[model samples]
Target chain A: MIILGVDPGLTRCGVGVIEAGAYRRLSFIHVDVVRSDPKSPQDRRLLTIYDGLAAKLDEFAPDVVSIERVFAQENRNTVLGTAQAAGMAMLAAAQRNIPVALHTPTESKMAITGNGKAEKIQMERMVARILNLNTLPKPADAADALAIAICHALRPAGAIQGGEREEHLTAAQRQWAKAAQKASRGRTQGRAM
Target chain B: MIILGVDPGLTRCGVGVIEAGAYRRLSFIHVDVVRSDPKSPQDRRLLTIYDGLAAKLDEFAPDVVSIERVFAQENRNTVLGTAQAAGMAMLAAAQRNIPVALHTPTESKMAITGNGKAEKIQMERMVARILNLNTLPKPADAADALAIAICHALRPAGAIQGGEREEHLTAAQRQWAKAAQKASRGRTQGRAM
Candidate 1:
């Protein structure tokens, strides 16, 4: 199965594609970053991302797309931009009728490095090792994208088919799930106020 | 001059169009709300907003587009969704090369009701009075959209032309600007960490 992974951001979005063979073998296909100028208007910046991702989707034509699910971040503006960028990635995939799977940062880390709390450098090294690349991918975002792709490749069967309705989750996945649920509750309470 | 105002949201996005005629006379052109199902996947919901706003832009063909500037809301999920929806509106406008203007909620309230902290009902009443509508626009989102359009109509000259580079601002505007600056700073700091 072919897979595309996206690490979404307005300033610098990461896009990576990989082909998964039988018995969990993986081959790197492409890796790149989509960047928008900060000086441009917000709308123009977002359009750059939207158009860039759409073109990548057409070129790669992956069977499935996996993106990092957004979590509450310390920076409101950054998080907002990240969410919008993620939305654009999902839209591009959906427009092409590609199924999308969302994975948390911890889940990707665990899949790549066997540690949910693995550091960035560890994750990068593992991604390089798994893809059999001689060197690490330049720019952390690119490595992160590869990690997301690897996560989807190693996920339990039928995870992507379920579409946000996973029937089973590992202990680490359940922990992140609980955190997501709590965060959602906090949002509802905020609306009431 | 023709103007389009958007009140961006995930569940319900409001869109309003108005024509500013000679002698400052305002004529209502259109008003409606675009909705997306909450149960749908996040990508589909965003596409709904994107397609809906794209259709509105094509139909109205307004000279300029005005959208509500998002603030740091207590509800993270809602705010994230709102930001993505607003991005869609901006993308639609930018694709058509229409100049885009952003007005804060307080700014719109002050422009419509002469009070920065006006209640919803008061703002709705003033919007109806300003638009010469016998009945208030259905759904609070529609009314909010109208208020944004009116605010753009009566704003100081050259504001939209400046494109986020306004040289001068009122005290209230400066206050909001400061808050936005602080938020940006927080984002950069988060990125460093």
Candidate 2:
């Protein structure tokens, strides 16, 4: 299965693509960072992030998209922009009917280094080792993106799918879907995992 | 001048439109709430909000779009969603090449009721009085949207314009533009107010 991972940010969003094969062997497909001028209008910066993710989604068409879930406890100066970028990534994936899975920083770190509080360099080293690469993923964000993708690939089945109905989802996901249906009563289009 | 104001939220996004006439008179144009189920997938909820705002932007073609500026200090559980909603509002207006203005909740309250820390009921009543309406605007969120629009109308001219060149902006805005231009060095499109 192919997975596209996004480390979302307005100025420098990181995207990584990887494939998981038989016996859990992984192969790297692509990695890159999208940049936007921070001093530009907030809307303009947002458009850059959105358009970048949309292009990546179209080009890769991965089986699943994994994104780092942003927390409000992050730096106050950057949390809003990060959340906006992440939102655009999710929207791009949904538009293509690709399933999405969100992994927190801790979860990704745990999956990659077996330590929730692992240092950045350690995590990068682990990523390099996992992919058998001689060099580390240059920018920190790109390495983080690959880590998130690996986390999703290693996680058990549970994710948000585009236009999915409750009956096809697991119990926990179904409960949430049922609550959504109950609130909308009749007009909601459809829910996800 | 026509202004569109958005009190952005995922579950109940409030949108309001108003016209500024001669002698500083303000006339109400429209007000409504767009809701998406919270239990639905984050992407689906965001799409609903984005589509709703896009429809309004196309229909009104407002001269300015005023959105509430969200802070990370907001309730931890809701800040991310609120920021995403506000980002979508900005995106919708930007897509139409309309100028976007951001106002804090304090600013909106001060404009409507002359008190930055006024209560919701007070602000709603002031909004009704300003619009010469006998009935209070239903739903607090809708009233807040109208208050934000009024705040933009009453403030001096200064805003984020769509695709504006650095030369056309004020000195304060120009500083930011120059910084962005310096960063991009060559390839950035145009910036805004």
Candidate 3:
């Protein structure tokens, strides 16, 4: 399954595309940041975002889109613009008949890293390892977008997201546990390189 | 000059159009409330707003658009959706190369009723009187939208919006005051009927 992730912001939005393969192996297809000029008027800025997202949707044709769900409580100054940018991303995905899923930042972090409170550097390293990249995804926002896509890809099949606790994993999900152990071991080996 | 005013909301976005003539005379061209089902996914709802605003921008081809400037500090629950809808409206206007102006609720209310804190009924009555409507504009959002357009129309030439207080009106804008007085008198007569 293909997943497109979006970390939305008015000034800079991040996008990443990946394909989840058998045994939950994830491969990176693309990662980049979409930017708008702060000097431009608000309308133009929003159009840039919408147009960029739409173009990517056409190019990637991902099966599903994952967006970082932002809370207004995060920052008073930027929440409105962030929400607007997120809205544009959502519209771009929906117009193409693609299903969109929103994951909180914490949820994405926990999926990418075992810790919900994983720091940025840790996240970049984990994302790099999972996608088997030679270098880390740069500019934070792009890395976060890729992480969100992975979060959606990691969502349990036919099970609700944000609800399943690790301890309560179903018998079939124990397979996921085994795979996660392998990924963790891979991370340990990757640190040496 | 034709002005389109949008009062943005997720469930219901209000749109109003007006023609501003010589001597600051105003006439209503259209008023509507675009709605999206709350039951629909968030992405679909945003798409509905974007499509609706785009259609209006094409149909009216307004010289300018005036959208209510929402603050994140207003209502935490709805402000995000409101900002997103406002972004859609702004994008529609910008895509058509029509300038977009944002008017705060206080500015719009002050323009319509001479009271920045005017109540909904007062704003509706004043908007009806200014536009020479037969009856009050139904739905507070639609009325607020018309009021925002009037606020934009009433904006002084080359004067910055949300600044330059009434006490500091230039000699030219004093003409707007006279026209405002005429509108106020019209409101009194409208009240009798």
Candidate 4:
């Protein structure tokens, strides 16, 4: 299966493509989507991200697309940017009816580093080690996109092959996660105050 | 001075621009950079983001660009994507000789809502309140980009004016943050295990 991994951002996005099934053959496809002067006007910036992402989809077609799911609430600006990036990515995939898989940051990190909280240097080292590359991917973002692809490669076939794996988290699991998140938010607020 | 706030991502980047120091005129911009494959080949995807961002810059011509500083460590993949987006944005601004300011998530949140851990709804409400807008900006990211712009407007003139801001973070601060992060990682690892 050919899995496409995307590290979505409002300005610059990292994209990596990997073909796995037998031997894993991974390739670096693209990295960085830099938007300028977000201060100008809203419609124009949205149009820029939409058009740019569409062009990428047209250029590289894959069986499945994998993206990092964002769950951050601390930085309102960053969270919103990430959510928009995620939304735009989903929209692009939805437009083509392509199945998209969202992976938590932990999932990708654990899959690559065997440690959920592995530092960037460690992750990059692992990527280089697993891929047998002579050097690390420059600009850590590229390494991360590659790591997400690796995570998809390591998952069981059933978890990712048929597009059956892309369903939302189980209702109970979602509820639990949400509750935990709410609790966490309360704690953070208490601490801040 | 015109300050532009950008929420960058691979898909859609939310941008809001406002004129500061006078009547405080506000303008919003949203740019979309959608890639078909989040995991497209790196060169292709990078080009897409670069071109899209370049086009937006040409259109906006912002004097100062303010972006959210990423502090996400739990989601390695998300952080990587955000870093890439931020990198692209910085590079674009550098090319234009425009001053760039990076704000931590907390700073932006506090600036907007008077609360560092404010909820998304709270942030949206505050953005509307501060901007005196009838409603919140759509897609959350748009509101955030606008918030970044507003944050810049609120900063002391010496902090963000005259191309005085450095393009990157100081090494000492980065090391300190990373060291603290590493220590936190050990704690989280112990708990997870």
Best by TM-score: 1
- What residue runs in model 3 are displaced by over 4 Å at the alpha carbon? A158-193, B161-193
RMSD to the true structure for each prediction, in A, is 4.9, 9.2, 9.8, 13.0
lDDT of 1 by residue, A67-114 (tens): 987755434547777877888898788778898887877768766766
Tens digits of per-residue lDDT for model 3, A1-193: 8999999988899999999999999999999899999778889999899999999999999999999876655544677788889998998888899999877776676677766678989999999999999999876669989999998888654334435666677654544454444433533342100
The DockQ of predicted model 4 stands at: 0.04
Q: Judge candidate 3 at residue B121 and give its lDDT.
A: 85
Stretches of candidate 4 off by over 4 Å are A23-37, A157-193, B1-193
Q: List, residue by residue over B23-93, the lDDT tens digit for candidate 3.
A: 99999999999899977888999989989989988999999999888765564566677888898898788
Fnat scores for every prediction: 0.40, 0.44, 0.59, 0.01
All candidates' lDDT scores? 0.79, 0.76, 0.80, 0.59
Candidate 1's residue-wise lDDT over B43-64, tens digit each?
Answer: 8888899899999999989999
Superposition-based RMSD of candidate 4 using all C-alpha atoms, in angstroms: 13.0
Best-fitting candidate, scored by DockQ:
1
DockQ for the candidates, in order: 0.37, 0.25, 0.29, 0.04
Clashes of each: 0, 1, 0, 45
After best superposition, candidate 3 residue B155: deviation in angstroms?
Answer: 1.6
